[model samples]
Target chain A: MIPLSDVTPSALNNVTTQFILLHMARANKEPGLGAATCLALVADETAAVHFQFWGSECDSFRPGDIIRLTNGIFSYSGNRNALVLRAGKRGRIEKVGEFTMNYVETPNISEIKWVPEGASGRYVPESVVSPYSRIFPPLR
Target chain B: MAENLLRPQPYLAENPLERTLRESFDTNRRILDPPFPLSIPTPEEYLCLTRAILYSILTEGRTRGIRLKYLHAIVVDGYASFTALTASVVDELFERLLDDAKEQIVWIAGEMVEVGAQGFGDLLVSLLRQVVGGDYGDGNMWLCFEEASLFLRKWSALLEEDGEGRSALCCGFYCFLRLLGDHCRTRWSGDERLSALRQLEIDFCTKMLKEQFSLCMNVGRDLIRMLQDLVHVPEFHEIWKDLVLNPGAFGCPLFSDISQIYRIRTPSRYFLLRLTPEMERQMRFLLTNLKLGGQKRHQAWFWNKFLGTNPERETLVIDLIRFVCCAHHPTKEVLHSDIIPRWAVIGWLLKCCRKNYVEANAKLALFYDWLFFDERVDKVMNIEPALLLMVCSLPQYVAITDSLLEFLLLLVDNYDVDRMALITRGVLTSFDVLTRSGVVPSSDALTSAEGISPPLKERLGALLLRKEDHSAEAHAID
Candidate 1:
């Protein structure tokens, strides 16, 4: 698994990694969908990012589960309207361990306000809107 | 420009956590109006953003001045409209777009339809279909009947117009009412959420029909057509049963008679063809109650007078005409439905054509069902012009009857006859058509007026001569 710090905004394709979910918020329904989704904060010792869980995924994983993601996407999802690392269609995730790894939960990738402007005209984090998940208020 | 100075620029810096909280705080303060000057989603930029919209999506302050509150409305409208022709690339971004679209789509549609914007009208129609189609769950679809009724009231002129737009609206209204009836009739348990959803939709359906129907004449007519169409559906029969059997379930749809001959249209023949036994039973119940004799009080509040002096009584009869006509045009539907008794329609025609007497009607107003009894109903150029216009606009079958002759002759008794000006332009045209069509005898047109007072004889006699002269001119010209 890649170190969470290496999973940068520049990492666009084939972002596979493993992390412990430090905390998760409740599932929410966005405007169009008939189903609810959840947004949470996950971390590895080196860095942290926001993660979205859809359908059964919401219930399958919990705050302490150390999960593995294969071919996952780190992009915008749900009402949070921010980038989140998620097990998108080509991606598969399974619980490999629980609370055994060191992790950090700051600078949620979802909190970063991304805009399409770079030297290459690709999505770049123009500003960081928040350092943590708003829904899953940072565990004090 | 001064207001821009006050809006915090927390979004510009690389601090996502502070920005998210601040956005929520902004939303809560109700300071959500989109400051458009700052809002911009560049097409080439939006195209790039459209693919993922995840990392590319902007936060509250980031997306070129788009306010989430209004964006919510835009989204609801988009959700409701089946006709939203989306570009192929815009697909993936919708889930991302949902955050912005999270509000009710109520008023936007009425405004859109009013402005005659095509895409928005489809949204309103879709919103209607969503509720009626039961495509929503968990009370999420708050079918604002008030808005839907307002939609008809607001967009009617355009909806009634002839074109692709008109046809789409026609189909929209047709499907909407039919689906609404089905929605109301469906069974649901009284769980708080489900019950509220059911009740709101039902209330909207009832109000569109009852309270607000008469707000505009064309809207009222269109609503009637929808209800008539609704009753024909087996699934919709319950709403029909409610209207025809439960007096309270129905409302007086006619508020004014300014609806000239121009307003009447050929009503659907569907209900007429299949007037089932159950339908026949309910219509009879409606007719029996509609008879003005028994229903003088519950139908009105401030005005308690019966058909003679009561505004409610008069309005009830007028609404009764519209209500039944909604089932089918009064003339043709009468052949099937008992809701409109022939005698009552004739009685109404005569009542409408009541001759006006200025001094008599004014003085008679004070005695209005009080200690005194008086109804010197007549036309003195102070005619019951509402009744006159209504009488003139009836189906040609009703307008050409011998009963109409009796209605007009009732005015011949008072010979201060002002034969020069008609109450309205259409009234004169209708009268001329009736005369030329032989419904009114051409020869000695006022022969019966010879024995009236001198002024009456002179005026009536001159009108008779003018009619003959006009007939001669018609042959010479046309």
Candidate 2:
């Protein structure tokens, strides 16, 4: 059992791990069973993840519930920035002891450093191909 | 110098009214911001101010002309900023001014007619701008149309006398007629007003036909045809048919001549909803004509005249077919039976099936098995029977040979028997071929499937013998 603190939303690869401290919940309708609720969770760190529980299971888990997941699948939802937990069979929910939870403050806007001229941004760097040294072709 | 000194300066008038008017007009040179502070000036005040300015202009007509230009500027600025002079007030001023200067208006119209085609066209456009810009309420706007139409009729009469761009002017005249006709159709009420408007429209259209036979001959033809098609509505059909067929007797074109006629048969919340069933039928007929095999000349003619360039007819056909296929209740039956051909309908459905790839692949497997295995249909179009059979056998192949055996087992346990059977067959067929060719290693397959589905305890008994046999076979081969 991995601790919730150690699992980053960005690095959540195991399908069968419990996720606590979910912040957002939205109600969506599945085709056959009218309305179901989806929960968007992020671990104490800043990385974001989404998990969906449908039909009878949706009624069992609320937004603040501490849920333990079993037998689920991780798939990319839209972009690579987030992963979705889909088709989970078993979820054991435990009541949170306290209503109040401490959250880390986001970094101050003024404190962030700008990149230097040659430094690359967050994406992985690729080697330049010979004829494609420049990112864009010159216009006529 | 003596002549300049002797020139009467109206600003020097001693009367208190004149003095105050001059002072306020001069001081108010700068643009006024609303709330304009001043009380709403009466029509008499406007008239008095206009007269004083005109009097000053006449005294020094040459140099004073330059100063009078500033009056125009001031009026424009005042109109823009003054909230007191509302639409009604502005409308009254225009009506009064036009009433006083009917002769001047006629003179301007005559000038336009004498100045040849381009000049006349420019003048007419300017007049239209002036009319639209005038603050006539929607009702009074129709009143202004009478004067405008009279002036246009007089101007159009000069077409034969002065040989010019008669065709272009005729087209412009036709547009003006349409605008006025639309206005009457929308705004006019009472039997008298309706009859008057209808008569005016008929007269203008007739004049246009007499002047240029092809200005919109087909439009009239279409209207006649539409009226004939509405034979189900006996009263309306008879009224329309009588008016259209006996043009000279009833003073209107035959309904057949009115192509693409949009009659406001019923009033709606926002607009008079235009119903043109005949026009829609004609368009569909034209589209079908273009789609017909061979007769490229007819298709080309239709495309050039009606369809315009690069018409997306193929996509349109596909959409129409899809619409029919997905329609509800009564509409579904009507579309399936009457609207599109069977071959075309099937083609469209196939296109949708291809676009929705996963659904298509699944359905295709089911359809192939159902058709061949159960002998459902005599023949399937476009796809070969042998390929269909091969695709259908995929799930069975996957079950025997794939290393992701646990996933398949889980699928069987979790899903209904029908779904499990379908997916299993698809996966098995693909895996069987791959296994036979030794494309996938037996060990890697087993490792990948582990822990993903079902408890090892539940499946361990059934797989023990096969696992041992595979391992022994591998050792023997190595």
Candidate 3:
């Protein structure tokens, strides 16, 4: 089992690896049953699958935490990419000590960007380029 | 580790989730980049959207404004939407924000009054049709009626000077009156709460009619003429009676004039009795001008000729009463009760029954015969619950259990036992205590003569005890 951080997206393209991360995702209790944690994660470079942990595994993981996994199987469940890890493979999993979750945070245009001194536009001139430019760079 | 980790090198990822998110961002970018597209909408466009939402809500359709609480929030926060605010939301917001400030209410009132009568009239007519035609349930009907009534009331007050406004107001008032009449005739039945609401409607119509009498009389004569066609409708009779009897409630002088006009032209004795003093004077004045003799002579002649000798007029009054009171056709014995005269009881029962049913007419005739003729007649005999039975049934009567009870009691008294078992079971279900007492007179008399009295009471008592036990068990479980 390769460590998740060491497994690059390209290497994950068609290869299966066991990964355990604190599978941080929205958790909801199933009707008349135990809690479930839903995690959206990439299994390989070409595909991403969501993994759901039920019962004890759901309780064992915390969001925004890292755990290592061994023998995690990959499959697509409905529209989501998924990983399934069983208790027999629990010993292979380890919580990584250092990991930081990444969130997309766009700066407020009015606050972060400065327009040229002589700029004239309908909106208050901010140095920040349009969010569109950041989303889709010029073809060149 | 600290410097490199804190200032991590940027990495690029190509993945489906990231791709979708990236695409979404691209779309937002495209939407925003163009001409820095003006976020501010034109005033006209904004007004149009608000109007659309207002119309949707008013017409009982779904609105985004309601789902999002956009209307309430916008009004509360004083946030200007791209469109003008809907009248309904504005009204609601005003009530909340200004707490019914007289000045704001007046401004709203002015705006409502300015709306074209044609548009307002169409809206009111459509609403009235829905309510009267039973297109909506009671709660929705109440809401629609309330909104239309309040709107018209305010508009009427503010735009009395405008001919179009006055006409629209009258049209709306007429529709409401018709709705009330229909409610009384069809849906209300023995529902006391609804009956009370109908009474309030009557009061409202009376008030509106008084305030807009001339306009109503002018436009209303035509409307009344049309309504006259529905006079045979039970609802029409109910509302018409209220309108006639309580002319002052409408605050309309023209109602009196119209009432007198209806009296002279139609010579309905019911309408004649409902005339106010002013109406009487107006009729006399009109008659005098027409050389039908001076006011007093015409009045005496009118009363003597139409009121005194006109059996048809009397019959009409009796019919109106019969139509109004008896939920079921009154038995002859009930019609003869000393507390109410035979004619009056027959009239009341006629009013109570649905207008178009053949059974209603048949029942009315039966009641008439029972009231006016000797009780010994076969049809009338045994038609009333024995005095003791009636007394025993008084509590149920006051409770207004169901119309079936009244019908059963009347039928049982008349010795119609073909369905006695069914009636007995219904009574048992409705009044456990009374059923257990085993004191239903007609049934008791029949059973006693058959020599099954003691056993019958025991059976009844046992059945009631079992039922009570079951009920207790159910209650405990609940």
Candidate 4:
């Protein structure tokens, strides 16, 4: 399995990684379809990214649950400009273990201020937003 | 549209962006890479930094020249918007970004056109979507309405002058209009919902004319075509005044070809969901913009002052015979049922609609014909024949001076004599009431009766009791 840090926004790379959920935001209802979604900062040893859980997935996963994302995607959500990492339509995720994986929170990949022009002429990070999400605070 | 998949990036390298950004920021930096890659910035800082970059462009792009390569690098980097910016800042930020983009198109000699598009195209659209979708400060409906009004005014100004034969800028402006339109169309909703913003924008835009914004010849054309999909303007020609009276403003004039004029289809009946509330408000806003009172102005100026009677009480009653009412727009059924309770009689009957009588944009006439004759009506909406009789029986249904009667005669001529007989039987169901109703003209008026078909006149004559038999006509009929 590759580290989350290796998954860049150059193209849609089929990602399969195991990460422990550090925190999860409340399941918010979306606008059009009103589907529920939960946002949480998930991490493995190398780096971290915000993982979004949709519908039943939002309720099934919780903080400290080690989960394996199979064929997940990293991309920007339409309408709302937030970049996200999720198990897209063709992807799947399931609980693999308990809170056993080592992780870090300071580099929530989603919190970086990505300039439009990055080092590789892709959306590279510019600065830290915060060590964690302001909307969904990390579980103390 | 899934724009990211098909789009091509600009040719600028990454190093120039870091350098140019440092200059724009006036800071010493080896590189401008994020402290952590792809991290979302604080909403406040993102807004601050974005505002600063816009300032540099609007200022520098105006005085010095466009930093084309620098701008290209920024767009190529790809925007990582992990959060939706609040509504409060969207309008301000969008105005600056669009204004700067507008200037970059004009003063930069077209080199920055792609930069303006690639950079702000998605970003500004996302921002505008946020603004239009969110509340204007305190959630005041009027404030929302006014903001929408102002936005329509602003976007309408984004015109490209093929003045110098600069196709690049024209094409870029066209893309912007297209992108903005895609985001704003087809969300049917009440005023309280975000979808109503699309309707408000549609209504506000219909009020602007191309003549006012001389540079908006291309942009205005795009806007109207965009609007044509939102609301059905039955009289598209009336708006343009035949292009003869108002020349050259249209890039593609409304109803250019005779066939195109006939090609009009109203926005699907999904529009009817909010029509009852929206229609009044839209009409008022449009009339008020023209410095006229709402329903009162039409009643006073045309009917009272000149027509020698009140038009408020008069209605150009459309007898939609067989039932072409939309399954989606069931509200018309409510209005139809209320015909007898609301008023004594829908005093003026507009003759049945015909194709040749009305101009090319005869969609209303066409709709009436399709409603009566179309086979689809039987499948969906079953219009009762009793309602037609009640409408025919209204006390003041026929008046000598009503201009609408002229069109009804033409309908019988166009369709067939039998159709008129059907309409006459429906209207004059009871022979006793037929004597008081002079729907059919006197025989002496025959010289002018060519417009009315013979079968229709004969049907009307059958309903009419002769003056000699008038005393016993009711008894004889019974």
lDDT winner among the candidates? 1
Tell me the lDDT of model 4 at B101.
Answer: 40
| Worst 10-residue lDDT window, candidate 4 chain B | B1-10
Per-residue lDDT of model 1, residues B1-478, tens digit only: 0112122322122233323333433433332343422345454433222221211122322532243334333332332221242211112122122332212234344444554554654454444333323233432244434434554565455545455345444444444454444344344333464445445444445544454333322332334434653464454466556544553444553332222212343233222222222223334443443333422211221112223342212322322232333342233444345333433443442353223321122112111111111122211111222223333434443433233333333333331133212222223333444445454453244334333345443554554555455545545532
On a 0 to 1 DockQ scale, where is model 4? Answer: 0.01
Ranking by lDDT: 1, 4, 3, 2
The C-alpha TM-scores of every prediction are: 0.26, 0.23, 0.26, 0.24
* B356: Cα error in model 2, Å: 37
Kindly report which residue stretches of model 1 are placed more than 4 angstroms away from their true locations once superposed: A1-140, B1-100, B125-138, B143-150, B157-161, B189-478
Say which prediction, candidate 3 or candidate 4, comes out ahead on lDDT. 4
Q: The CA-based lDDT of model 3 is what?
A: 0.35
Worst 10 residues of 4 chain A by lDDT: A97-106
* Candidate 2 per-residue lDDT over residues B47-128, each given as its tens digit: 4444444323322334353434444444533322222221212222333333323233333344335534234433333333
- Candidate 4 residue lDDT tens string, B1-478: 1001011222111233223333434431211323322545455544344433433444445422333333334332233321122111232232323344433322332232222242333233222232221122223233334445433444423333223223222323332232224324223233254346445544444333333322324332223333333233332345445333444444454434222221232222212211222222322232222211112222222222212332211211221111122222234544444222111111211232222222211222222322232222122122222223223433333332112233433443453343444323222232222222342233323313444445655644543434334335424432
Residue B188 error, candidate 1, Å: 3.3
Residue lDDT tens for model 3, B224-294: 53354356655456556656566555555445423333222111222222222222333333322322111
What TM-score quantifies how close candidate 2 is to the native fold? Answer: 0.23
The CA lDDT of each predicted structure is: 0.42, 0.34, 0.35, 0.39
